[model samples]
Structures are given as C-alpha cells and as structure tokens.
Target chain A: MRGPLSKRLFLWTLVWAVVLTLSAPTFVIIGASLTAGEMLQFPPEGLSFKWYRQLWQLDDFKHALTRTFYVSLICTLLSLPVGTLAAIAMVRYRFRFQGTLQVYLLLPFTIPLVVSGLSMMLFFGDIRVLGQLWPVGVGLCAINIPFMIWSVSASVNALDPELENAAANCGAPPVQAFLTVTVPAVMPGIITGALLMFILAFNEFLVSLFLTDSRTVTLPVQIYNSIRSVITPDLAAVSVVFILIAVVTIGLLDRLVGLEIFLRSK
Target chain B: MNRTLNRKPIAWTLLDAVEISASTVWPFRGRAAVARAFLLPAVLVVGLLLVGLGYIIEYSFHELDITTYRLKDEYSIINYHTVLERPVYLRVLGRTVLASLIVTFLTITLALPYAYVLVRTASAAMRKFLLFALFLPFFIGQVVRAYGWLIILGREGLINAAVTSLGLPTLDLIYTYPAVLFGLIQYMLPFAVLLLIPAIAAIGEDMELASEGLGAHWVATFRYVVLPLAKPGLVGASVVVFTLTMTDFAMPEILGGGTNDFIASAIYDSFFQISNPGLGAALSVILIAVGSLLVMGFFLAAGPGTLGFRSRV
Candidate 1:
C-alpha cells in the first residue's frame, strides 16, 4: 500500500528494532564478560580475558559444560531414531485412532517443564532412579521425542508415499524401500528435528535440576546455581559462551534447511 | 508388476514367495500387535507421566507428618484447606492468574500486528529474517533468558543505566510485579507469533482487499474480517501462553526476587526446600486444576472442532 522505499525502510526499521532488543542481552553479557573489574560491569574499564581464563579454573563450570554436552548428545541420538520411527508410523499408517495417538504423543510438549520435571522427580525418585544421568537423559529424550516427531512428521507428510510404493513395486522389500526412498526423502526433516532436539536437550534446565545428580550437572543448572549464590563476571562469560553456541547452531540449521518450516512445525 | 514366476532362480523365488506370504498373512494377524508395538513407547512414557500426576493428585488429599517427612495415606482435604486458609497462598494464586492473563494478552497484542505485517507485506527476505529473529530465543535456555532479563532489569543493569544517563530518576521496576510480567511477556511472545502466522496466512489477501474495497477502514477490516478468522489461533495461543506463564517457576524465581511468588515457586519451596511433598503435591494439583479449567474454558468457548490444533500436532 505504500511506496517501495518507505516499505523497505519500515521493514528494516522493524527488523532492526527486534534484532537490537533480542541481541541486547547477548552484547551485554559479552561486554560484561570482558570487564577488567571483578563485578559484572558493562562498558568496562578495559577488556580482559580474565573471566574466560577463570572459567576454566572453576571445575564445577567445566564439569557442567562437559556433562551438558554429553547428556544432550546422548539424548539427541536416542530420540532421533525413535522419533523417526514414530513419524514414519504416523505418516504411513492409517489407523482408527490416528488423531488420538497424535494428540497423545504431543502431551509432553503441552505440559509445563516444571510439572514434567516435578512428576519425573516424584516417579523416578520414588523408584530410586533419580541421581542417575541416564534417567535424566531419558527424561529429556521423552520431552524431545514429540518435537522431533512433529518436525519429522511435517517432512514425512510433505513426502510422496508413491515413491515408497514404487520402490516396493520395483522388487524392494518394505524395509529396503524405507531405507532407499523414504529416509532420503525425509532426511531434511530428520536433520532439522535432530538439531532442534539437540538444542532443546542442551539447554534443558528444569528436568535436569530434578533428575541430575551432582555427577551430572548440566551447564544451565550450573549457571542457575551460580547466579543464585553469587553475581560474577564468570556467569556472564558462561552466558556469552552459551549464546554463541546457540547462535552458531541456529545459524547453521537455518543455512542447512529453511528455519521457517521447522519453526512452524512447533 | 513382476508377477511372472522365475523357475530358474528357485531358491530366491521361494524366499520371495515366503516373504510375500508372510507380509500378506501378517497384516490381519499381527497388524494390531504391530500398531500396539509402535504405540508402546509413547503410551508408556505418557502413562508414566500421567501416573506421576495421578500420584500428585492422590498425595494432595493426604495428610503429612512434618516430623517424619512422610505422607499419611489417610485421605484428608487439610492441604487444600491449608492453602485456601492462608491469604498468602490465595493471594499468590490470584497474582499468578492475573500475571499470566496479562502476559497472554500483551503477547497476543504485540504479536498479532507484527505477524500481520509479516504475512501481508509479502517480502520474502524480510519474512525470513523476522521469522529467524523470532525463533532465535528458542535456542536460548529459559533460565539464561530469565538471567538476561535479570541483567537488563537490575538496579545497575541496562534499563537503569540508560535512565540515569538521561538524567532521569531510576524506576524500581525490577523485583516487582511488572518485572515478572515483563519476563512472562518476553517468554510467550514467540509462541503467540508462531500461532498467529499460520492463521493469518490462511485468511489470505483477498478478504482484506475486499473489506477495504467495501469502504471499511484498516482497523474495521482487521476487527471484522481478520479477527474472526484468527479466533481459533488466538484462543489456542492464549491457552498455551496463559498455562505456560501460570506454571512458570524460573522467571518469577529470578526476576520476582522474593517480591512476588507464583504457585510454581511456592510448589518448589514446599517440595524441595521445605521437604513437604504432600503440601507440594497439593499445590501442584491446584495449579494443574486451574490450568486445566482455563484450557477447558477455551475449548468450550471455541467449540470442539477448533480444539484440534490445540493439540500441537
């Protein structure tokens, strides 16, 4: 409805405002991490890598970082195959209770993280499965599966079933057809789902809090405990690192497959 | 298409015949069993999760011995009574509901226009960029995002720094109700936008053009044509956002700074710090009940068919 120049300017202005607001915290954390002073001071007296150096010295942070990656990686690996199978079943099979099953699968996504964590704590803690890293990873996997299913299902739905039919018609077994035709066609969805699942598991906190033992504290849990006890530039340093990892991961995913399709599936 | 029998490859032909026979036979006998197998994991996980919730519901009605840190199986409504009797718990519940409602409203209000622009503008590049910007925070953990706001809203944080630099007196917005509200709004904004986009896109441009051509102003057209079509999305987004904010623990814990306590923090304290599982379970049951009632209200208002997309499938 407006001139192209004005429209372009409006779009740019809108975008810049959002980008600035969203990235403001990232900048502040980065700046605070580089402060020469002991406190979290932005626009510091001088830039220094002291906090980054000290971050390594803090064994809790170091351990938490390693544990976080381990748990996230394990969870992602477990959820990917399970989620892919579920997605295939949902897309390929026409059953009487298909819609109901789809809804049931999505229950974890609708429930709050705190509630889920609390429930897992109660269930696992009662069963003495608490304080185990695998159970924690499993709980996170449970949450991630639905999201993985949804994203992959979106891709699966987009795929032409006739390809699988054709493969089967051309003397391929059902399993062979799935491997040769279905998996390749849905690889984008699988990759997108895996990336999102990894990120979710990587950044998960509430579930980790309830399920993790001292031996398996994730980074977000570590940062949270640190923040509660003290206000230090080290927290900012860790936050800066977290933001960078998130940005890089998200940017890579956006480049690999369009972000919009993945997000809309959410 | 390869129905012709190849007698030369006898072994292979027999194997193929066996495979085809098994496949055909399995559909009637084992299809149900296979379907159940495919569904077993989801059912087990969800069933276990619900069982946990059921345990909470059961525990909420039980009596607790503070001295032993044990729950007495004898049924009692004492915990609910305790919650209702204390004005503090009731007040916190009220504040939690109010905060979530306000956050949901603010989220939809801000997101709707921005989403409208995204869909209506038809700028592929801008849409991609804005969509990416919107989803960027999903990458960041909620704890970190809340902590980011803690930095922004603190006394010496960015907001205060900017205000003081302008020679204006600093406002004590942090560690108060508004701080909690602000954090909730920020958290729920992306969800609201995501829900609205598809709904808006589904309406397409013809409706808007037709409304405008009929002498309707942009505002009128939006209220009349666009809003009605987007009601399902609006309802679904509101329910999700409201329930999320209502049960949120970390945001209020970090930003509320002891000035406010939502049901989630209250539940956390009872369950963890106080080691009162019965009381904690009671509080959780109450929270879930309230959340479910709101969801039910949405479903009733929107009617049954519209609740389909609310499943997030």
Candidate 2:
C-alpha cells in the first residue's frame, strides 16, 4: 500500500524540509523578540527580555490590547445566541432558498476582508443609528457568524431527534426540551466555535483597520500602524505574546477536540 | 412511548399552546415554519449588511467627490477604465495572478507528500508531532508570521547573519517579490495539508495495494490512482489557496516594503491613501469577479469537489 522505498525516502526528506520551513517563522520571531541589540537582528546578538519589557511600558500597546480582548470576547458572546438559533433553523427547517441563505451568510468568506471593511466603513458612516463600537461588533459577526453556524450546526445535526421528541412526549415544552436536550448535546461545539471566532476576531487586521478610527483602535490595527511607522524588536515581542496566547488556547482546544474537526467541514 | 401530558403544570401547557400554534398555523404549517422564530434575527443582520455591499457597488460606477467624501451623482465605467489604463495596476494584477498560481502550485505540491507522511505514518508520536507542527501557524496570526519573515529575511536577518558569519555576500531577501511569495507559501502550506489530508485519507490502502499488484510502478500508481482520487482535495485546496493568496494584504504589504505591491495594496492605496472610494470599489468589484471566475473554473474541473455548500447526498 505504501510507495516504493526510494519514493518513500524522497517524500520523507521533502516532509522534513517542509516541517522545518513551516516552523521556522515562529522560532525566528521568538528569537528576534529576544534580541538584545538595538537594531532588529536574528540569531540575536545577545538574549534579553528588554523588548517584552518595553511592550508593557508602551501606552498604545496596553490600550490596544485591552480593546482587542474586549471586542473579541464581546463579539464571541454576542454572536453565540444568534448563530446558534440560525444554525438550528438552518438544520431543522426545509425552506425555499435555504441553500441561498447559507451561501449568503458565508459570503464574507468569499469577499475580501478589506472590501468588507470598506463597505462597513461607508455603512457605519451613513448610519450612526448605532455607535461605532456596536457596528464593529456586528461587523465581526458579519465575518464570524457563519463559523458559529457551521460548528454548532454540526453538533445539532449529530443529535438524535428521538431525545427531543421523547422530552416533548414527557410533556416538557418545546423550549424546555431544547434547553435540556439539544443545547447540552451541542455545548462542546458551541465552546469550540466561540474559541475559534475569538481567535479570528482577535487576529483580524484589515477589517479592524477600516472599523477602528482614532477613538476605537484595536491591537492588530495598532500593531499595523506602529509597524509602518517604525520596525522594532519590541513589536516582535508583542507579536510573540499574542501568538502565545492564541497558541495556548488553541492547544487546549486541540486537546478537547482535535484540529481534525476543522479539517472536516461537514 | 405514551406519556402523561395531562399531568403537566398549567404554566407548561400554556407555553406549549403558543408553540404548537406557531408551528401549525395555516400559512406556517411546514417544516420551515418550526424554524421561523429562530431565523428572524440572522436574516435582519445579514439583510442590513447587504445594504452596505449595495452601497459599495453603487459607488463603483461613479467618481469620488473627495471634498464631500461622497460619490458623485453619476454612473459610468470610468473607474474600471482607469484601472485598465493604469500600467501599474495592470502590472500588479499580472504579478498577483502569476504569484498566486505559483504559490498555489508549490504549496499543494509540497503539502501532498508531507500530508501523506502525516496521514500514513504508523508511529503515533510522529503523527502527533506532524499535527502539532501543522497547527502551530494556525495559532500565530498572519501579521505576526509576516513580521517573523521580516526578521528571517531582513538585511540583518537570520540568513544575512549566517551569510556574514561564513564571510559570504549577504542576501536582500526582504522587500522583494520572491520574499512575499516565500512567506505566502509558508502561510498557505498548512491549509493545503488540512484539505488534502481528508482526501488522501479517503483513498483506501486496499486500492493502492491493488494498483501495486497490477504491475504498476509506484509513480504510475500515484499518477493514475492517487492523483485522480485526491483531485477533489487538490482542486479544493487549489481554489482556496489561490483565492486567498490573490486577495491577501499582509504578506505583500509587510514583505513587499513600500515599493512592491499587490492588488490588495492597490485597493488599499486607492481608498485610504488617495481618498478615492469609487476607485476602491471598482478594484474590489474586479477582484471579486476575477476570484469568482477562478472558483467557477475549479468547480467545472472537479464537480462536487468543492466543500461547505451542500449535503453530499
């Protein structure tokens, strides 16, 4: 079933090279972040945590970091109920244009992030019905709601209808049966989905760029503007911090439900 | 399976009456009716955002009135004409397409063998390591990874340090097209593997054995058997990787320095730098059209190969 010995050996070498290449950036970033030199250098001249210390001293980074967490967390929480209900309707209902609706919600995926960001800017500018932060919140959901729907819908689809019907037959109301039966069954999916969207919103840059004015700057947008103004190891250190946070959370998520779950779109 | 519904509390009975009527009303007596309450919020939000998209599309045909920060009250294809007439835009478009094609090809090619190794390896530890290695980037944001490349490929970056250590000429890898392509391929490799793994996994071991038994060389087996079977994943990964690369903003911006630019960079400049939303809209419309065209090609090439839209059966 395997390839010939030589073929396998050739592939093994290729894979080794690829693994190194894929992982090299993270190591290099970590290494650069530890640089003691004045200029950003790799294979750092001397190891130091000065850059990491410098990040704490910077007001821009502190404020941006707080805003990033606040937005990502709030958006994830806000998106949960709406996304869960939508996923339920999508999975349970047999309706005209259901397929169209699914694609429409996922349209953000196909549309360039920057384009959507521009659209949101024009929109929010026109309609001040909601404050700036609220639109940014909804905009995050604009891109992320589909992910929640997909993740939760997978769990919803996996549930046995018999359980809900049984609860209903036992005189439990429909909402009560759903709360008792369906929600718990899908809790893991919901948890992972929230984590997934949190990471995405936290890391998102281009849309955040358009959404964030002077008043509401996000971490990634701040990092972006700062990088343009000057290149420094302190920025690298900040990036390392962000990556570690994401990696640690994702590590836990992978433990709870394998990354393979994402690979399987269904 | 009979249950005593009559014994339930009046509170529960009252709630059930409303729920039952909602699902069973004359105009709502279908499977879809049961879900009407749940779907209303998402519909409202999506409908609202679509209005934004409508605004952008409306603006693309007009000129920007920068003084007012509003589009001119006119409709024409002049913005598209401007994009076509501008040599820099044309050059960037060509480069973006070519770079995307090359990156997609290389990412998928490299990922195939690595994916096979990861999937087929008998040792659990190796698989775990491979999985860890693959998922590492998912944790790291694209901007961070691009910045990482800035460190690895900068004038005083890792490669330069190594070259100078050897008393050789230091290479300027950053601030160039190759550097952008290199970084993009690294970023996209994991995605390709993720898509390809499921496809390669779908090809049973027995089929490979059967091909080998038929006096076919392993290469021939791969060419005729594995490749064909994995086409769905290949096509899917290709469409995804190419579109992502084409629309990408970070790699080209971070690695391309101030001079080298992609379509996204052009779009960014038109809107943010020049205060020209009309042009920005035109460029975005073009990007979407081109991206959709390419995706259509992939779908035509590999029917049902695309994932995420519908149930398989």
In TM-score terms, which candidate is top?
2
> What is the TM-score of each candidate's chain B when compared with the real chain B?
0.86, 0.87
Highest DockQ among the candidates is held by which one? 2
* Residue B262 lDDT in candidate 2: 88
Worst 10 residues of 1 chain A by lDDT: A1-10
Tens digits of per-residue lDDT for model 2 on B137-254? 8667788888888778888777898899999998988899899999999999987997787678777878888998999888888899889988877887898799889998988998
Interface RMSD, every prediction, one decimal place: 3.9, 2.9
What candidate 2 gets wrong by more than 4 Å, as runs, is A1-3, A129-131, A156-173, A260-266, B1-29, B65-70, B304-306, B309-311
Q: Is the docking of candidate 1 incorrect, acceptable, medium or high quality?
A: acceptable
> lDDT value for candidate 2?
0.80
| Candidate 2: residue B96 lDDT (0-100) | 92
**TM-score between model 1 and native:** 0.88
